[model samples]
Target: MTNDENQELKRDKEILSHIQHRYDEEERRFQSVDTKISSMIGVLAVIFTIQASLFINILSNSKPDICLIVLFIFSLALYLISIYYFIKSHYFKKFSATPKPSFLMEEGAKKESEHTIVKDMIALYSDCINDNEKLIENKTNIAKKGFSFLIYGGCLSFIFLLCFLLELFV
Candidate 1:
């Protein structure tokens, strides 16, 4: 009912809104990362299916020469692409999104000095949050790149296998 009480309530509401926004942003980033990873896994699964079918077809057709060569090339390409993706995912997840140390220290003297220190601490925390956002963006970019290449590589291998099968049977 009081004016001061209303002002305090308004400030608290604003702070709560800001915190919710940050949490929502973080959750969205995490979901984006998860989606990218799931897509990459799907791509890999398709590649493996193709490879398996190629192997079975090659063995069943009894034409080892041509089928073997095609399979070898396709497998080699997939292997190389997998290695690249592995390295990229490894590095991105390992180095990115590392939280930095807070700037608040325990050595401030006097009330005014403590106030300034608290302000600095808040600024540092904000900077860290910004840094985390940038890191998430970087991770998303890396995942997107990896997923794109994975899809391309998987499709290429699948097509290659299909062509080989067609050539063998027809």
Candidate 2:
């Protein structure tokens, strides 16, 4: 092959390589997000354990205040909402690319050239990016919801604990 033709092929290959690299990066990002969400779920479980223990301890008290009981119920509801969101956050689907369909082949079949390969690669990379974009948005939205719930739960629990402590000390 002529030097010019070889150079052209190399450049096309470089473009495809860059796209593949981006595709891989997006995949890694999705995995990282999934791992972080899983960790958050674990933390929420621990919070639930503490909440349960607190409820039992409070109930065992001989003179239980009705207001404190109401606070406990409110906090319990918040915890339930938080756990639901955390579980939902982990449920977003991961993007998995399938092999290029044979139907995508051009109607007029010709010898496979470097240009054709590069074109196909670019198309596949475009599809990959599109899929990843949706996945990222979905995961992010669900994560936000989960975090909001968690924060609300924490705030309610803190208020309850502060009031309960005041009751004991004063």
TM-score, predicted candidate 1 vs. hidden true structure: 0.58
Q: What is the lDDT of residue 115 in candidate 1?
A: 37
**Distance from true position, residue 97, model 2, in Å?**
2.9
lDDT of 2 by residue, 1-170 (tens): 79988888788888888888888888888888888888988888888888889677876874668887887778777777877776786787767663346624651265577677677777778787888878877887888888887788788878878888888898
Question: Candidate 1: how large is its RMSD?
Answer: 5.5
- Per-residue lDDT, model 2, residue 21, is 83
Which candidate should be chosen as best, given TM-score against the real structure? 2
- Which pairs, if any, clash in model 2? none
Against the unseen true structure, what C-alpha lDDT does each candidate score? Answer: 0.58, 0.78
How much does each candidate deviate from the true structure in C-alpha RMSD?
5.5, 3.1
Return the clash pairs for model 1, or none.
none
Worst 10 residues of 2 by lDDT: 99-108
